[model samples]
Target chain A: MATESGTSTRFRSQTADFDAETGLAVDAALAGLDALDIPTTQRRPLASRAWAATWPKIGALALFLLLWQLVVWSGWKPSYVLPGPGKALSEFGSRLGTSHFWDALARTLVRAVEGYALAVVIGVVVGVAVSRSTILRTAVGSFITALQTMPSIVWFPLAILLFKLSESAIMFVVVLGAAPSVANGVIYGVDYVPPLLVRVGRSMGASGFSLYRYVVAPAALPSVLAGLKQGWAFAWRSLMAGELLVIVPGHPSVGADLQNSRELLDTVGVMASMITIFVVGVVVDAAFNTADQRMRVRRGLVAEGTSAVRAARGSRGLGVAGGAVDPVGSSGDGTMPPPADPGAGGGDGGHSGGAG
Target chain B: MTAVRSDTAVRIDGVSRFFGSGAARVQALDNVSLDVRSGEFLCLLGASGCGKSTLLGLITGLDAPTTGTVDTTNRRAGMMFQDSALLPWLTAGGNIEVPLRLRGIRRGERRERVERLLAMVRLAGLADKRPHELSGGMRQRVSLARAFAQEADILCMDEPFGALDAMTRDLLHDELERIWRETGVTVIFVTHDVREAVRLGDRIVLLSSRPGRVAEVFDVDIERPRRIDSARVAELATVVTTRLREEVGRHGH
Candidate 1:
């Protein structure tokens, strides 16, 4: 027991006994240690990285198109009914140039923007408010989660009843579909923020709304962004459903055209419109994923910004925020400790490197 | 408020902190009291579950004692946690600038102050590096810089170097001591390492665990620039450790 005490308190730096040479040597060692801090990884060029990310997606598109063409030539269905990829591509191309198609596209795009904007405003306001109040959270937290899972199609009947067969009806459903996800995003984001970061902020003299703004809000951003992505998905689906159900006269919308093509049995037109929907879905989803990915990379939560880099690393998906992820990614600012592992912990690729 | 208390940076009077309520109530500190003199380096030393951190929280105003008072008067406190607690999203310079920005310091001034703090911590050129980009020691250095950015009179550190390797911890000890001496900022450093406490502290306050109470306080008469390996430091550390073990022994069945 006495020996254990002696060992525990053992000290090594005896500068009192150190002569001038030893001190200079120690200074060199210290300087060497300082210089040996891990080197920051170089960023790949933007054009190359962009190309790298684009290729696999392009390759997948080619593979999908080839299979679709093969299926048509295989006589699985008549050409008129199913249409070949080539035929559909040409039809979509032709539609792109036509005023009629552009008008329908504009109508669809306009509705999507308006509905989503409304949903975001409502969702963020409600989500932040509900998260802050214990009583409100207890009252409506679970309810929001329930709404997120509910098929937005379920809301169309009620929306129609409230707003009639107009743009408002479509917008009502879109906002309903999107808001819960956004609100839930903010709530969960706020709830999951690490208590340690909050304590640091408080000690730094952050209080009241500024604390919320600088610390809590920024810390909660990752989850909130996730929520917004989910919310957009819901809003898009609702708008599509609304466009089909509440077809207003004089409005040549994407959904209305889809309905018209099916009724007229203009199979090529139907395929083209279906292509439009699929393309829009892919594009919007890509937009959200890109935003999320860039944000994560910027915060250093993930290894690299480009999807190609992530794919190469065999990472399952964009990393979540925490010790496992990175605060350097999309969270509150602080001198947060990296995880235990050197390779995994530091903002980008950290190492507990250097001993001199 | 009185003239006699003018030199005291912090005065804790009969502070007893309890968690929970009723039968489940757990007392973390039992009538713990100490005075942190202005511009002095004080170490709160004890084993795990000793309420060393609880006491720190009280002094920092992050938590309050259930009984008694902790009076820091008008002086603000800046703290360093075990984890760097650096916002992962910001660069090292950005992290140091947090407190300054919180006080609504303008952007130009914030940048200039962050640069100075970074240089003070021996991290001059790496301000733009994010927390993850730097090593553990580097991150901790940034954390230290951020704490100092608050420009508070009292600095509270909760095992700031506990997770670091021996060499890094030793180096940081030198850095912290140099900074303390240069700035004359009163420090209330918490640590479990006996040698570490002896190496850095002006006086060591040892608390016994399980309803922590002050078992003893030792004045470290060792001269400035005392290394952890010094004979005098080792001697004091050994004496303190023996008493700490005795306190820990009381808990054993």
Candidate 2:
């Protein structure tokens, strides 16, 4: 009994030592990750990281404004044609205080949102149909590609002819412009889902709709997100064009504002409206970028955290290869030492590391 | 080890499988017949393109035989592939929960079963980890747990450990053998490795390529906990390897 108790005490101490060793190794590995600008499990506060990301964008905008001011100062074009940056800025500031400007912005945004939602529904249905059936894919696949490449402006005339310069005309053109790209994205995503995953799903008794839901959809998500981003670009551009062409009597949109500014020879208003459109595009694109980045980081497809940390690590010449640090923490877990054969463990380690 | 029961877990009779048609047609399996006894660890040993995996497909109902029959008594068969095939989106525990969810097991039961399976595979505390975050061996272990979670009477493994390093493979052999012994589930393991077959298989059936057919069947009388490098396993492997080589030689012409 005494010997057994002594043995138990010894085992407890050994376990304690092993746990301490593992803790040290984990700390060291996390430090190495920090040195490489790779985030460990617990990252820094989100707000600071977001601020770190935002500053560069702000800098780029400032540089863009400086460039615009220099171009205006060069006197290449008359002030009537290309307004000075200060003139546009003052127009923008004044516009921000006006209720009419906000209403116009809101109207344009609502139309774009409605059109985008419709495009998503149409694109997903058509894409899934074409992807599932060889006949549909063969017959309509090229047609869809052709449609995507076709100038969206071509659809505007038909849309206006059908709806007679109404909001419906604008929405019709927006849907037409975006749906093809979204469908193509879904098709490509479904086509490229790893065959092995499908087989695995099948082995688990997943069939038909369940198979698509549990396996196909999730696997195709990254590509689908890519397509959605592309589709949004098309939708946004088409909406702007539509608003410019099809002016409803009471609805004052950014696109309508551009046309009015052009007609009235308010060059500063036109430039300000153009800047607003450009900023809107950038802002929407940034939203999509953030969503895509989050998905990529979650999948471990890309590294997370601030580029400033990456640059700092780069300057230090640490050159620690990504995905090399053992996450299992087995190196220091003495009690659960890796498989008896070092060669075997080493080979698998190399393989998984390279794959990651 | 339990006595090899007379009751069969899987039976394949006069099975022939052909892929494509006319000019492009290629026969994958021809007149292959076999019976896997209940609670037996049977290895389907063959060369590349020997239809070992095709035979597994037939048993698992992933593919139907063009001629003849593969009867698993309509019982669902679990399968593990060469790759881990764990869903990237799901965590290790979530992957295991897939089959349980499919089988319509209650949420409470699924959670309990997933934990048990994870512990069985020695991957406890790794439930929340993504497949990419884990080692290859760990991922494979998760895959194994996923297969076992199906609770099928028969488990078909298609060279599941072929991509694993030797040490990991050896460790897994021990784990699989222990699991098989403990659960008493019938296992039909397909592999090209003769030592692995000898190490794990209670019965080894050799197949020849070019319209794969059963070339030989050897009853492995080795005791439980057989080591891959054991002299007894080596002795049996030599005899099986010689027959396997002869089968491969026949295809050389």
Candidate 3:
């Protein structure tokens, strides 16, 4: 018994030493790999990356302005009908200094935020509900798609009739237009969560709300975010349409200013208002794009560098490629393949066959 | 055969599972019964359609038997799948903490347990690394740590290392044997690899496919820390392979 105990102790210590040595070896190898000029796919500094991303967008805007100026010079229409780029820029510069323009912008933004928030809440609730129940899904799944396909303009007339040309009318149209898309996003996202993950969660004793909260929600996040982005675009469009159709007495909006400019034949003001709306849309979309990019980066779904760097890494095959590695034990010595009778077997035969 | 010994971690009595309905109904398990003894590493060996994973599902309570009863004596079983199935959004440490959090373990205690489990899996100081950042072997080690975190008496592993390379699999076998010996957890491991069964199992239960039923049970009686490539493992694996081939041949008609 004394000899046995001593032997066991010695064996235990030996194994511990072996493990520590392996750890050190792995660390050293990793350090070596880092030190080597393997041309790491490290991203550029944030400032440079931002500059790289922004310059093209600025160039596109300048090109668009130049094209407009050229179109005016060619007399595509009279300057009164299609104002020159200079006339529009001057009008925009003048509008930028006015408190009225700022107020109008703020009101439009507030209304968009309010309507979009309402749509998001409704969309998520409906989406989760529909995804969870086959009955609900069957009843309204196609109906939601149909609603999304219906133009936001179609809802404005009904909303105006219902709310009598108030701010609520605009909000109602916006919500109707955006909510369906958001709900569909949630449904699609929830539907696409891998069955393996769901089984894993269930095996871990998670059920009902806990399962949805912990497993389903996180897994479905990318899809949900995509849906939210689409919903915001719909909401913005619906809000603009509503503002043009129904002028709320207290709500000074960009759409109202556009209408006023059109009525007074101040074509440059109309163009400036249109530009302001376009810029606002682009800015909001940029915010959503940034959020999406951040999520993708966190998940390692997207490379951490500019496209040029990614392309370089791809060509050189220097970066860590996606996909699970081949089995470490595989010696290329062919083992007996799994039995090929599908009717009599589980589905893992193909998986093991490929590995072998 | 032993009248459901008190030490049995899992008891499946005359259980049969059938999938689909009417014309499509396929019998996956046919009147199969097994009693996994506590603290024994038992391997369920079978061909592809032999209901190995299905039996594991029943044992883990992920699925119920169409007939008969699967009794676990209210003991929770932690299961590891072929795929790591670690939550992609979580860090390695965060993944390990999942079951503990599910069990309502306090944050401080959970963190401590996560550290200890990671160390046990030889993945120390990798708590904050995301799943994608880790290699396949490392990810699986994190998964093993997560399975251990459930603190359950029984561990059900369905080809957990089947996807790994041979070298990694061998290393993990040593790691698993070590942990199993230390923890004394009743492990019901399912695998098709004959050598793997010989290397790890205290006793191996072989199953025939096409309405999977028990073909034979062999007590390895081999000493601990058996190497997969060792002569003893190879000899035993040859015998098991002969029987497995015979079982497959019977279905050839």
Candidate 1, CAPRI quality class derived from DockQ? acceptable
Off by over 4 Å in 1: A1-31, A45-48, A305-356, B1-5
Q: Tell me model 1's lDDT, rounded to 2 decimals.
A: 0.77
Q: Each predicted complex: what DockQ?
A: 0.34, 0.15, 0.26
For model 3, give the interface RMSD: 9.1
Which candidate, 1 or 2, would have the higher DockQ against the true structure?
1
The best candidate by TM-score is 1
Segments of candidate 3 deviating more than 4 angstroms: A1-41, A306-356, B1-5
lDDT of 3 by residue, B144-242 (tens): 888888876778999998998786787778778767755667789999999999999989999999889999999998876567888998999999999
Instruction: Compose the digit string of candidate 1's lDDT tens values, residues A147-237.
Output: 7667777777888888889999888888887888778777778877779888988988888897897688877877777777767767777
Which is superior by DockQ, 1 or 3? 1
RMSD of 1: 9.1
Candidate order by DockQ, decreasing, is: 1, 3, 2
Candidates in order, TM-scores: namely 0.88, 0.84, 0.86
